[model samples]
Target chain A: MRFIDDFRNAEHVKALAGSIERRAAQAGRPLRFMEVCGGHTMAIHRFGLPQLLPESVELLSGPGCPVCVTPTTYIDRAIELGRDGALLTTFGDLYRVPGSERSVEGASAAGLLEALVVYSPRDALRAAQDSHDREVVFLAIGFETTAPTVAATLLEAKRLGLRNFRVLSGHKTMPRALRALLEAPEVAIDGFILPGHVCTITGARPFTFIPDEFGVPCCVTGFEPADILASIEKLTELCGPGRRPALENAYRRAVRPDGNEKALALLERVMVPVDAQWRGIGHIPGSGLDLGPQWLEFRVEPPDPERPSAEYSACRCGDVLRGLIKPAECSLFGEVCTPDSPVGPCMVSSEGSCAAHFKYGSQTFTAGLAEIAENGKGY
Target chain B: MTEKTIKLGHGSGGSLTRALIEETLLRYFDSPLLAGLPDSAKVQLQGVPAAFTTDTYVVDPLFFPGGDIGKLAVYGTVNDLAVVGAIPRFISCALIIEEGLPQSDLRTILSSMRQAADHAGTEVVTGDTKVVPRGKADSIFINTAGIGAFRPESALPDAEMKAGDVVLVSGPIGDHGAAVLSAREGLNLDSAILSDCAPVTEVAQAILAGARRTSFLRDVTRGGLVTILNEAVGGAPLGLLLREQDIPVRPGVRSICELLGLDPFYLACEGRVAAVIDAESAPIVVEAVRRTPAGQDATIIGEATAEYAGEIVIETAFGTHRLVQMLSGEQLPRIC
Candidate 1:
């Protein structure tokens, strides 16, 4: 708890909150800050940072959750492989997430799929090694933080000559996705709290375009309460009237400006950037990473053309992901779409905006709204 | 409708398990006694009120850092009976052993079970054993059913929880879960973590003695504390408000949870007991619980609230509040 306890210190948090308030007051106008990582979304809600921030500073949840951004088609295809007599493995979060028609759980319940939750790609390899008769397909879905491990796993599989293993890669690159969001006309993001873990891999250089091109301040911050608050403070000062937009690294301890060279090299050797389809957001060019040609045989095939595509017409996940609307604004938010029976990935993924709002933000917001109605202020 | 096959989540003892009980199992066996869904079934047997509870243990690896499946099987049933304010007296064990299991391993398991029963002061008077083919079952599976005499003078009803009641948890959460997970996954952490698997009978007795009214007592087992609270307030005109900072979680367990991307609140604890007591008597009950061996880490974690009825709200250390939902599906380790 060396790093963790220090970040959650009550005295430090209070002092930071006071400084953030002062910075927000100096800005005068309302400021919108978006943290583009599922980890950040969860941390912000877990620490209840929104209530501590000034009313003029609004935090918007962007498409940061890898599981939330993964398209339903990917889940559908993974389930299809499981039904076709292949052993499927994925991180636990994907087990209950709904595809167009069925989830991995639903498919397993129907006795058509044999799926297991593995903590890492190595575990998936071990499962394949343990079962010689069945082919094991690992559903690889994550950002840069996890893709390097998957790359290493692929390399090891090749070195070990393990032909029974394959990967269904849904791995995405965060920089391009962030670029897409910044370019979106509907999104009114004032500044960005860049993903700290991803920045640790690809480094702060990838995010320079955000400030230089779009004139939006960006801060690479850790997931701790203090890191988030300090990043918000930096963004507030940078967003001041006369200050030039800049990219600052508030999470300097973990993230270097150049990032991990070995991880970047490993990604370069095993994978290439491709046009990837995000679940709610449409396809962004060169946003997804696919296994290199040497690993193509290990790639799970696409879904059959005859299978009907499923869509949640009632869900506003796309709007929510684009920061066009808050999760509560969605019509199916808490009523029909809940954590138990999620109508959208936003409600299903722990990092998704809807899940964070439903679990932490909504009730707190309601309580704050009630207090404001009575006393004219939330805090 | 086509019958849906069982999934692992149905056995996770979380929201899915509750749904299975209420939606499928309870539908077939509808009765007032079954409707209560207490940890143990309360029944009058030959003019004597008794608490009867049964539990099955299918833990992997058979043995863990602090205890094995045998001890878990024994203490699990005894604790279930004890939480109902009963004096656990008799236990019946029925084990399903696989054919290829080693004889020496069987002896070790049985010996551990005997020691655990002795420690809890309960008698395993009757037992049954069956051997299945190698592929049919795991190495071994244990089923224990316990019976305890319920004294009317000290009866603690499960449905007696009211608004403003105090919630107390005996000892830290997630020790058993983290220990088992680490042992299974081979996580060689810097510190050694052990399972908190023991009978909570003494803690329960002390709590009942000190509290003016003990509303309910639940062993935080497979679904951990949050699930138990959710079940405790199901459909009731009350909610639970917990302070995140007050909840006791060991540093090692916290580190493991952080590394694995899991929540300690949803992790399992075999020995801990979550109790609801009258607000005024919380201090006395906490003191009483502290005197017991199992309740050395006892503290008031939260209180029953009228706001957000049937929901559990946690006031985070950062001065924000969030809802603690029941564990849905398995507590799978997150990738990111």
Candidate 2:
């Protein structure tokens, strides 16, 4: 906890918060910063950072939760394979996410599929190795932080000549997604709080475009409270009057300018970028990673295209993910959708914007607001 | 549609397990004692009140750092009795052994149980054993039923907690959970982590002695500290406000939790107890607990409140408040 505890110091956090408040006041205008990682979103809520921020500064949660961004098509295909006698293995977060008709957990509960929750891609590989007769499909999800491990697993499967092992990848890259967010005309984001873990693998170079092309100051920040406060202060300074937008690494302890060379090489060797369909935002060109030609045989694709996909018609998860609306604005938010019985991906993934808001924000903020109204004081 | 079947979540002791109990088992066993749903049931035997509790051990990898399944069975039952302000006296153990289990393994397990019971100052006086087909069961499973004399002056009911009660945990959270997980995953965290799997009878006794009136006392077992608090506040006009920074989690356990994408609040602690006492008596209770071996790390973690009645919330280290809901299912690792 050496490195972690240092960034979570209460004294340092208070100092950073004071500086951020002063800087925001000096800017003399509303500023909106978007954090483009589910981890960052969770951290902001977990630390209750929003309450500490100046009223004029708004933080938008981007479409960064991999499970939330993964379209229903991927889950449907995975379920179909699961029902067809394949031993489906997936990360825990994906198990509860609803597909077109049913979630993998619902399918497993109903005895249609034999799904297993695994800690790593290697666990899936071990399952495939253990059960030689059944095909094992690992649901590959997440951004750069997870892609390299899946790539290495595929290489190991090849080295072992394991024919039963396969992957249904909905893997996405962070840079293109960030670029897509920037290209949106409706969003008025002033700066970006980049993902630290993702940057640890892909480096800060991929995010330099945000500052250079969009004139949006970007800071690769860690997840701790002080790290986030420090990053916000840095972004405020960068976006100050007469200051040029630049990409900075606030999480220099973990991330570097060039990133992890070995992880990048592994990902490049095993996968290629493709046009992937995001749940709310439609298709983002070259945002998705698919298996390369060498690993194509291990890819599991949907068996049918004509099948009608089930939709949660009343859910406003797409709008929520895009920061077009808050989770409270969704009609079905706490009533029809909850963590126990989530109607959409946003409520299913632990890091999903809706889940974070519902779990941490809605009730607490409302109660705090009521207290403030009664006492004429701010918390 | 797939046919419904049993899953691992059923045994996780979280919301899912509670649902299973309410939907299936509770219907058939609707006695007043069972309905109370205390860790141990109070029974009147010939006009004298006694505590009766039963628990089954089904932990994977029978042997783990600090303790094994047999030790856990003994300590788990003894702790359950102790938390209810009972002087644990006797226990009955029932063993279900698979056909192919080695004699040496069985001997080791039995000896461990004997040592644990002796350490707790309790006697496993009566026992039964049964053998099953090789594939019918795991290597071994032990079920223990304990009987203890109730300390009438110190008895703390499960629903006795009130607003302004201070919550204190006997030691660091998640050590037992992390240790077990490490042993299962072969993570080599054994160098830094060890299971806090022991009886906390002495700590419970000291807490009862120090507090003028003990509102609640529960061993943080399967469902962990948060789950226990959630259960304690369920349907009651009470709320628990815990301080995240005040919660003592071992550095090794914290690292393991980070590695597994788990919250230590929901991790099981076999040896730890979560108690609620009146605000005025909190200082005395903490002093008394700190003097005991099992409670040396004890600290006041939170206080009960009327705000957000029937809810559990935590003031995070960042000075923000967040609701701590009972975990719905198993804590599985995330891809990220």
Candidate 3:
């Protein structure tokens, strides 16, 4: 509660909003910043941070949600493992993620397979240890924030000599994906609100490329409202026409400049970067993580390639992830594709841009926002 | 195509479960009493007005901090009857025990059930038990059907809701959910947070006694406060605007929700009651509820609104409105 309550203090948030408004006035230009973390996206919408920002400042969500950006092919592979009688275990976020034909949850619902939602990789390891007769496949899907734990779990599995334990990994790195978003012609991002959780592992250096290469201001941000507002305030100050681009660590309390060395070492030992397929974005070099040579035996891959892939031709999730369009810009966002029956991964994952927008951003009370800002009390 | 079968989400008390009852179950059982779909069905037994309800408990882990499944089974049914303005009198319990369950554990659960019934001032009149193979069931499952006599001038209907009505919640939300989840996952959250799995009969009775016009009353169980409100507003040309800061959530529960990236509003509460009272008697009802120990934390969370008909929205701490949709699928832990 220390960090949460203090950070969400209405007085502090109002002060930061005042500072951001002043900075926005001084900049005299539209501030288009992309929040490159799904946590940031969710916090922005959940806390209604957009309403606090000045009219000139706009925040766009990037490919931040790990479950949303995961290619359906990986989900297909995990579902296939479940169908092959493997007791599949995965993060709860991936349990309902549609995988081409169906999800692991759908398979379990149909009585075709067994799947469990585990909070961490260690739980999946425990499941494997508990079930001796059935093969337990951990569907590993996440960004750097989760990769170290998966690496440690894999090492533990090897140490225990568990023959039934395996992992279907869809782990991905962030810096490369951020670069891909920048290189696109349609996206015109001026600054970035970096993912604080990932930076706690990979550190601030990995994201310096955004400023050095593309002249975009970057701020590693936390999930709290004040943390995000402070990051936006800093980004606003640095994004003025005459100002030079810079990388600021707004979430220095949690993240270090160099990151967690022990976790990085674990990732280096057990995992290797590979060209991976993203859901909306195409394959990116060295973006995905796969088991290293020593850990190959613990890996699970799709048995066949000619399986059904996701039918997402109508879903503008790609545009939404790239900051090219809002979720409402898509035809199937709220009507046909909703949280109940999601048509794409964006609508499925709570952290996905579309889902966040749909869940919290679809409606706003104009009177409430103006009234609160005027009184300086309601917030 | 995969054949449809029951999924875990169907038991989550969210939209899927709502659909299961409204779309599938209702189609087969074509009775007006069942069609109303209140927590308890209104009925007349031998020329006396009565309320009847049934619920099944299959909570995993059987035991948790503050309360276990047995206490939950009894309190859940009794609360259902109490919310419908009924004084619970009799309850029928059925147990499905799995083989290999320890006798000591069974005795402990059974004793807890008896104690809970005693505390609620209800009697377990009839019961049944069956044993299944070791893998057929999780430790034990309990189902309970309750019957209560409706007091004269105590029938609260859903349509009684209107704009300007006050919504009050009895104590904090998400305690039971956060307690159970942290206990199951070994999250070691602040130990002060415990399951609020007590009977809401006292709180409900307080509202009925004090408020001149109590429009709606529901024990916030599965799907948390938001889901219950959505159900409360079903097909009614009314909206609810809840002040996010006004809703009571314990610090420990809020911390756990923050850690898991889950919304506390969507978390379940086994003992909390959400009620709508007429605008004139709202303050009187709150004062009356606060006099009771169980309702000490009771306060006005929101009010029914004419704007955004057929919807519920929460005004965030920043004073921006966010549409509160029914719990879709399940509130799963996020993959950070």
Query: Which one is best on lDDT?
Result: 1
Best by DockQ: 3
lDDT of the structure predicted as candidate 1: 0.87
Candidate 1 residue runs with Cα over 4 Å from true position:
A302-309, A361-363, A366-379, B1-3, B152-163
Query: How badly does each model clash, as a count of residue pairs?
Result: 0, 2, 0
DockQ of candidate model 1: 0.64
TM-score per candidate, in order?
0.95, 0.94, 0.95
lDDT score for residue A190 of model 3: 81
Query: Model 1, range B87-152, lDDT digits (tens) per residue?
Result: 898999999999999999989999999999999989999999999999899999999999998766
lDDT of residue B63 for candidate 1: 91
Q: Which scores greater on TM-score, model 2 or model 3?
A: 3
DockQ of each: 0.64, 0.57, 0.67
Candidate 1, residue A18: Cα displacement in angstroms equals 1.4
The per-model lDDT (C-alpha) reads 0.87, 0.85, 0.86
Candidate 1: tens digits of C-alpha lDDT, residues A219-270? 9999999999999999999977689999999999999999999999999999
Model 3 docking category? medium
After superposition, candidate 2 runs with Cα above 4 Å error: A302-309, A361-363, A366-379, B1-7, B157-162
- Residue B137 alpha-carbon offset, candidate 1, angstroms: 2.1
RMSD of each: 2.7, 2.8, 3.4
